[model samples]
Target: MGVLGIFKKGLTKTRNFFSESFTKIAAGTGHFDDDMLDEFEETLVRADCGLPASSDIIDTVKASIRKTGNDSREAVMDVVRKRMLEILGDKTSFELEEGKLNILLMVGVNGTGKTTTAGKLAARYKKAGKKVIMAAADTFRAAAVEQLKSWGERTSTAVIAHPEGADPAAVVYDAVQAAKARKADLLIVDTAGRLHNKKNLMDELAKINRVINREAPDANIHSLLIIDATTGQNAVLQAQSFAEVAELDYIGITKLDGSAKGGVAIAVAYNSKLPIILAGLGESVEDLVDFDPIDFVNSLIE
Candidate 1:
């Protein structure tokens, strides 16, 4: 399936949100009155679009409606789409670059689907004819190694792991060495998800970075923080904590399919200024997809 097909699981909630909002506004009978505006603001907030974003959207639509003397709900919806596009900007995704070993350091809080995402990403690269290997460096998590190994079996990619409670940095060091020996094109390093302690997170991530630089100086490691879309504004806090410690290049919002707060994608993009490279729509291997901003926002409206 294509990107949208993979993401369609999340589109239902988005559809219900906008559809309900559109109905409420239409019930106002072409009036840009206070009640309508309040409902609109509430809808945005409930959808996980943050306060500043929702207010800005409301004000812009109201201005356009006033200027044009068109108080139709359809006009407001059009303005909402335009505002979403503006927030999305012109960011094309950063796909796996060829010819060099692409390292994706997956980071996220517990249960945000980081491990599964790594496995899916490995499968994606393998399907694209690249040699892909995964480092199960999340040594602190009890089942992390076993989980990644299972995924490796499912995807038919090689997995590297050390014993439990071993230094994750050491696992990554070994994985990098293996990747070089095997001439692998992609090496995905998985890390443990501890509480958002700046010193601890930074120190651990620094160790991994140091190891990668020492072992494979030419490898480009992209720090991608995975945020759970269901958390809504809380995701902004998580993203901030992760970015403060590491030079996060991109974000992967997972479990969009199960979240009414799918609008967290917009809130996160607006707040973090980090491109959302991918979203997880299902548990299947093909469910992970590149985040298409236009298609995503349009799906919410449609």
Candidate 2:
């Protein structure tokens, strides 16, 4: 299937919810009336669009109706689509530097698929013919290093890790040396996700950044915040929190296929102002794809 098709399949639950719910709102009248507008707003919120975004969207559509005096279903939907695109901004893809070492720092609370995404990213970079190495810097979590090793094994990429309780920055130090020694093109680092103590987490990430900068000053670094879509509006909160904690370059939304809360993506982009560069559509390694705003909006709304 093509890229848009992949988004459609991944967002099946969300797409179906919007489709059926919107049709029900019309309910044989063939278009939305004032009475149906509240119900329409509820549909967006039910899909986890968040109250603020849903309100803005519905209010915009309502304004369009007032101005054009055309409340046809198609006209309303067109307005909805345009407003969503404005919220998402322009779609972006993950890009790598050709002549420099590119580092992807994966950050998020546990169970947000940060580690798995690290592995999947390594696989993608390797497929692109770049020599990729992974660093299991999430030493605080039990079995985190081992999980990364398994992905390294699966992807035929080298992983640098330390025992549990080891200093994560030390692991990054070693990983950078290995990347340099191996002349690798990309280094994907999986860091600890301990948001319970914000100061400690911030300190740990700072230390990791210091190591990377000292060890590979010329490397291009991209800190990606991985978010679980099923978490609903909490995902937006996480994005806001992480932006304060780290220099987040992009967002990677995971678990979109399993949740009807795909609207969380729009909510996140609207609130965070961080472009979503990756999406975890399914469980497989290959299920991770670049976030395409136009295609994503179409798949979810149409």
Off by over 4 Å in 1: none
| Candidate 2 ranges with C-alpha deviation above 4 Å | none
lDDT, candidate 1, at 285 = 90
Best by lDDT: 2
Model 2 per-residue lDDT tens digits across residues 5-119: 8889999999999999998888687788888989999999999988888899999999999999999898999999999999888988778888788899999988899988888
lDDT of all predictions: 0.85, 0.91
RMSD of each: 1.6, 1.1
TM-score (C-alpha, index-matched) for candidate 2:
0.97
**How badly does each model clash, as a count of residue pairs?**
0, 0
- Per-model TM-score on C-alpha atoms: 0.95, 0.97
